[model samples]
Structures are given as C-alpha cells and as structure tokens.
Target: MNAFEINGLSKVYENGNRALNDVSLTVPKGSFYALLGPNGAGKSTMINILADTVRPSSGTVSLLGHDLFNERNWCKRRMGVVPQEIAFDPFFTPREVLRFTSGLFGCKPDEAWLDELLDRLELTVHAGKKARQLSGGMRRRLLVAQALVHRPELVILDEPTAGVDVELRRKLWDFMRELNDAGTTILLTTHYLDEAEELCDHVAIIDHGALLTAQPMRALMRDIASSYLWLNYGQAVTLTDADHDALAGLEPRSSDEGVCLKLGRSENGDSTFHQTYQAAVARFGPPLDAGVRSEDLEDVFLRLTRRAGGDDAAAECKS
Candidate 1:
C-alpha cells in the first residue's frame, strides 16, 4: 500500500500566483523519497500541505490510507515535520523544549528515549543549554530530535543538512537510514543532490509548480544512461567536418576548454565509446586531454528542469 498519495494537488497564493500545479505522486511504505526542485519550486509548499501547516488550495492528499483533509487529526498524529526554519523559545533548554513539544502532541515524556535521541544526534552535551546558546548546527539537530520525539510513522525533513558539515551530514544520513529500516517512512526535500542520489529509493523532480518526473532512482538513472564527457586541450582544436561526422551519433558541443560529448546508450556501448574516444584523442595528438565520466543525478536534474523553462532553473543550478 502507498504510504502517501497526492492526487491532482495544487496551491495558489492570495495574490493569484500558482505555487503548485496538478502534482500527483505516490510514495511507497518505508521508502525514502526525495523531492528535488529549485527555490520557489513548490517543494516546501507540498511539504507544508502534508504537515497540515498549510492547506492546499485544491486537490486531495491521502496518508496511510486516510484522507488528509477529512482525517486531519489522524494525519497530524502520524506525521512528524522538521521545517526549514528552526523556531524556538530562546530561554528554553533542549530538554524543556522537547518536553513542551511532547505535551503538545499529548505524548508522555520519556527521559530515557529523549536521552537516546540527544546522544544519537550528538546533542547530549547541549541538552541543558538554552536554544540561543547552541550553534546553528546544534539547533538543526535539536529540530530533528524535536520532530522524532513523538515517534511518528512518517517524518518529513526539509533541508535538514543545509548548513551541516560532511561528518554530521553522514551521521544524520545513517540515522535516517536506520529509522527507515525500522519501518519509518521518510520524505526529504533538499538542495543537496549528492545526498538524494545516495540515500533516496525514489525521486521526484518538479519545476514551475509542475511535476516533471517521478520514478525509482535506479530506473531514472538507467533511462538516461548518457555520460557527459569533458575534454580539455592544451591548444584549441577546431572540429573538422569528418571529425564531427565520426561522432555523429553522439552530440558533441564545444566549450572554452575543449569539447563535451553527450553519449547516449544507442550512440555507443560503454566499452566501444572508451575505445573510440581514446582513438580520437590519439589522432587529435599532443594537446588533447580527455576524461569520460557517467552523468549523475545532478546532471539529469539540470537537463530535465532546464527543459521545463523559467528563471527558477538558473537559481536551482546556482544553489
């Protein structure tokens, strides 16, 4: 059964700006789903709607088989949300903050579980420190802990590792993996493509409030099995008509450095491409230094979203 299902979902601002358009997707139970898009791409809007923080202008949201709008309280009880903004009372310590959150959720406070959460998040030492006393990273960790305190079946993390270091980010990834392994579903939205590529089972890309594509991560990569080859030359080498014809199947484009060839699956097999590429380099002589690499999720993301249009693509690329 699907953990969450959004059908023809949409949202429009009071000023008449449409933030989300006819977006529909399903997330499987216990899966780590990553929602990728540019700033103002409606990622947060979708998340906020799911968290019951913002009501959708139209369409339906069903979570764990319960209609979100109809069974509002039940949906709220089953979902945990860690929003991008970390808000807290400056005077409240982590312990007090978590205790208050639990109270709001009507969950009995468990000191042992709270301690374990703090330890895992590496915030145990800061447990007694007020929110204002903690660093930015520490506060982010505290927000995650706050979301998990009630032990909801599904957790939504919006830019959870935005300003975190590599080590802590990896630690958090492992922790999230552990939670999903134990049957907790995770829905993540982040600008970090590497994290999404490494951790997500499913990925959905949206732009201009429209759903561009939603597929299993493996399937998406396989569907676009094209490697973007970057080549550098000590001296600029002008392309001959025959040279362009030789690699006709692959679309080759020139940049300031040298050239880039986008090799699709039908163009040449991996082994053949390597052999042909090396031969071309040898024939081109001394100046050319060629490197062939696979196209990662980031590359596919850029290509797909750029085709969708708007200035948001440029902003997302910069991010």
Candidate 2:
C-alpha cells in the first residue's frame, strides 16, 4: 500500500486565500519522497493538513489505506511529523520532553531508545538542559527526536535542517538514511534542492497551490536531454557587436573562462546546440578547456516555476 494517497485535496483559508488547488498525489511505501515548491507553494498548508492542524476545504486522504478523517487516530498513531517551527515547553529538559511526548502518544518510556536518540542526534551532552537553553540547531534536533519518540512507520520532515550547520546536517541525514534503510518511510520538504535531489527518489513540485509535476526523479530528468557547454579560454573574451550578432539565439553566459552557452532544444522542439556551438566556436577561437554541465534539480525547478509565474509571498499566510 502507498504511504499516502491524496485526491483532489484543496485548502482555502479564512482570508479568502486559496492555499491548495485540486492536488492529487500518491507516495509509494518505503520510498523517500520530496514535496518541493517555492515560498508560497502551499507545502506548509499541506503538511499542516496531514498533521490535523488545518482543515481542508475539500478532499479525500488516506494514510496507509486507512481514511484520514474516519480513522484519524489510527493514522496519527502510525505517523510522525517534524514541523518547521521550533516550539516546546521552556522548563522541560530534552529528556523530559521526549518522555512526555511519548506518554502523550500512549507509549511507555523506552530509556534505551531515548538514549539512542540523544546520542544519534548529538544531544546526549545536553540531555539535562532546559528546552529554552538550547541553541536553534539543538532545538531543531530535539523536534526530530520528539517526532520519532514513538517510532512511527511514516516520518514527515518539513525543513528539518533549516538552521543547522553543514556538519550536523550531514550527520542528521546519515541518521535519517539509516532509519529509512530500516523500513521507515520519509517525506521531506526543504528549500535545499540539492538535498532533495540527493536524498529523494520520487519528487513532486507545486507552484501557487497547483501541482506542477510529480514523477520519479530519473523519469523527470530523462525528459530534459540538455547541458551547458562550458568553454574556458586561457583569457577573458570581450563581447563586441559582431560577436553579439554572431551569437544570436545561443544565450551565452560569459565568464573569465571564455563563454558558456546553453545547449538545448527550443520550445518548438528544435535543437540548436550543435549549430550554435559550431558558429560560436568559429567566432571565438578554440577554447583552452571545455566540458558539459548537466542540468540538475534546480534548473528544472526554476524552469517550471518561472513558467507558472510563482512569486515570493508566503503561502497560507505561513512561512
């Protein structure tokens, strides 16, 4: 069974702002999936809906084959959510917070598991410190530990590494990879496209509350057989009027190392890479070095979002 099945899901806030359109998506069981979007793409709204914090205007959702509305408690029992915001009781220590959260979920305190979590999250040294005393990164880690205290089958991470250091980020992802390898399904949302590209096999991009593209990472990549041809001359090449006229339609980006031209098919299904490259090479002389840089997730994201006219406003009135 799929981890989640959402059909025609939509959310409209009280301020007459529509946060989600008729969005339909399915996340396969045991797969690491990414829900990607711009600032106001309704990703947060969708996460809140799944966590039962926000009510959808209209939709049907199933978690692990159980109706989210009819079997709400059942679904919640099997799922864990790490929110973007860091919030917890100021007086409670890390250990106390985990224990309390576990109890609320009807789970007996598992000291061994708790210790393991603290160690894995690098919070063992600060286990006795109050929540308010911890740094931003530590608190973020605590949030993750709290979400997993009960060892739910499905884990949803919304910007879990927002404020963490690079070393800690790598360490956290290693721990998460271990958990995913042990059969825990992960759903991640982050502004870090590289993170999503590296970790997730399946991806879905939303823009302005509308579903833009949802497909396997490999399949999505296969549709774009394009690359940037980087030509590095020994010296910088100055662009003249003659050069500009010759390089028309190539969209050349100049750097200290000669010029880089975008080589791809046009919207009308015409490939100009070979034609453009030949003409530009004849004009600018042979380069000292040359290579091709393949398009990545960031390229795909910008292209799709730009096509949809997405803006920088926060979605659902939440950042």
| Model 1 agreement with the true structure over 216-289: per-residue lDDT tens digits | 99999988535655567743447778778876755555556666565444354334556556645654643346
When summed lDDT is taken over every stretch of 10 residues in candidate 1, the lowest stretch is 310-319
Which digits, one per residue and each the tens of the lDDT, describe model 2 over residues 1-319? 9999999999989999999999999999898999999998999999998888888999988999999888888988899999999998999999999999999888999999999999999999999999999999999999999999999999999999999999999999999999998989999999999999999989999999999999898888868424666677865667787777777765566666677776677788676667766876798877777766666787778778884244211110110
TM-score of each: 0.89, 0.86
**How high is the lDDT of residue 26 in model 1?**
97
Candidate 2 TM-score, C-alpha based: 0.86
Best model number under TM-score: 1
Q: Which portions of model 1 show Cα errors greater than 4 Å?
A: 229-233, 255-258, 266-271, 278-290, 307-319
Computed on alpha carbons, the lDDT of every model, listed in order, comes to 0.83, 0.86
